[model samples]
Target: MRVLAGLIVASLLAAAPAQAQTVFAPDDPGSSGQPGGWVNDQWNFLPGTGVDAPRAWGNLIAKGRPGGIGVRVAVLDTGLAYADRGRFRRSPDISRFRLARGRDFCPHAGPGEDPCDGEDAYPDDPNGHGTHVASTIGEATANAIGVTGLAYGATLLPIKVLDRDGYGDQQSITAGIRYAVAHGAQIINLSFEFGTLVSSARQIPLVLSAVKHARRRGVLVVAAAGNAAQARVAYPAALPGVVSVGAVTEDGCLADYSDSGPGLDIVAPGGGDDALRPGEPQCRPGVALRPIVQMTYAGSKHRFGLPRDYVGTSMAAPHVSAAAALVIASGILGPKPTPQALEQRLKATARDAGPPGPDQAYGAGILDAGAATAP
Candidate 1:
């Protein structure tokens, strides 16, 4: 989804772009300045609380499980990093990687390398957000360097749609979706989102056409609900036939900053509005998508040497995406389930989260990775 600075929308608009201050720097590792530790090292967890057992999807990846062999997932974000080659080495086969054949629509903002690639051109991410997100999905965990990905053995296809600023127009996003589906991305993870709605009747055709194409292709699109915290919604996630995700705290309570509305299809662990200091209740069962526990490290540094805690719903979406890979790999789920069938199976089996039932606050309920895999 989105993270907010708690300022009124009007005030946030008035502030200069420099002062607007969005926490999600897709190009950066989210550290203020120096290099941050491995992506999974930042995952937050609640004591005595963990991913649900009987994970229908996650269990598929267990050793010796049928279809536990390597699965492929397409990570649509900024771009993958060679600096983190150590992370990919854990894969049983690393040659499965495919580069984006799409064009980079983002224009250069300043005196830095272009984060967007042109004509098969590759861009270096100065910010590292996309790398972090991709690492979460397929990073070779247990390699003993970076944090473990949900599907460590799964293959990843990197798609860069957003630039260093973490912003992209609808045209670029639509193109990215089509590219992912055509290129064999069974499960599409859209961690990046825009703040506008697709309202025009003319524009509706483009979106509907894309969504229909995905469904027909048997591709499941999982998107993050905006982090705006307001009931008002944003696109792609709010679009028809897409799964909208919200965030939960370590204790399973709705993150105060998480956006809630009729549009939400599910909730996941996005993180908290406030730092989840110890002694707070861990994430409770609710209408969350699969919960991605928050991760933290002691005295981590960003590329520039700034120090700060990293968190967001962007972190949660990958958990669900990788888990889906596990499900698809299980063979029980077959090549690909229709988006509607996949969505229903996930919701029906998710452990109930808030209000003892589905509500706008939690949607279908907290995502139970283990349980979601149950045939």
Candidate 2:
């Protein structure tokens, strides 16, 4: 049986790429320069409340040379498909980040399906979750187009462990971790997770072992705290050496669906639109929290005008992963800081959100991209 099911869809507001403006109207798809749009506002360049990814970008760009070009992030999820052009109907944003081709654990299961085979090659995301997660990490920033990611300068190593259904077995996931570690992913984003892990050794030995392997090699593994409303920790997230992340609303309250427990590392803006769940209270348009925005497969070819809605801990993990990228790119931690040192930097610098310091609800606190990457 699957440990968990996919989350309910949030209120997906579509935005068209219009001329730069400051309006937050639904009629406006959204531009990259407006504070009303959280992606451009709270998540990007705007000061104080924003994650401050653009600040890191600014420091790097001002140097006249690109930063984060050498850091490689491994996205272990469904797959990566940005979009397409003349000869290609699809191109992953990982390409825009200029990352090398990583391995796909699943063998092609014919057209329109992704299932594992006997080979250690080819990773493509048909299910969209992986692509959305990747976009949050490095979707190409400040291009006068889509919303930016935290570390647009970093390269990607997309690894397709999960198939179309958003589920991957312990074997595939462990193998994927090993591949990432061996191939050199300084950071690994585990946006998908298994719920109700009873005993690590009994339920997921390989998974735990893989995490340890990554840690031994100085790789930081960031994972989702799961979307369960039941205030408990999930596997991998609770596992040692992994940074567990939960979701919080824009106002800094814990999200309605975010899971929490002893090991959660931190929280991020994982927009919650109650309307997405049936029978749940419907939040008025402006009054409701805005979901995180990024460019990815919307199943309807690249529609640039509409802001796509995706809200969950899955969305939160990458923000931290990208922040890790920014920290590495910033050179603040030195050319080769140990994984433990980098993780401590993240936890120590995080903005305290609830109960003063390091509460289970918000971990160390909400991620401070600005503080984490500041020179």
Candidate 2 global CA lDDT score: 0.68
Off by over 4 Å in 2: 1-8, 11-48, 62-67, 82-88, 91-97, 107-120, 197-201, 273-287, 301-307
Candidate No. with top lDDT: 2
Q: What TM-score, computed on C-alpha atoms, does each candidate reach? A: 0.71, 0.81
- TM-score leader: 2
Model 2, 150-244: lDDT tens per residue? 67778888898887678677777888999999998999999876876543545888888999999999899998888886567677687888988
The C-alpha lDDT values of all candidates are 0.53, 0.68
| RMSD vs true structure, all candidates | 11.3, 6.8
Over 39-130, each residue of candidate 1 has an lDDT whose tens digit, in order, gives 22233311112233223323553434422245556666665453323222222212234233323334444456444434244433434555
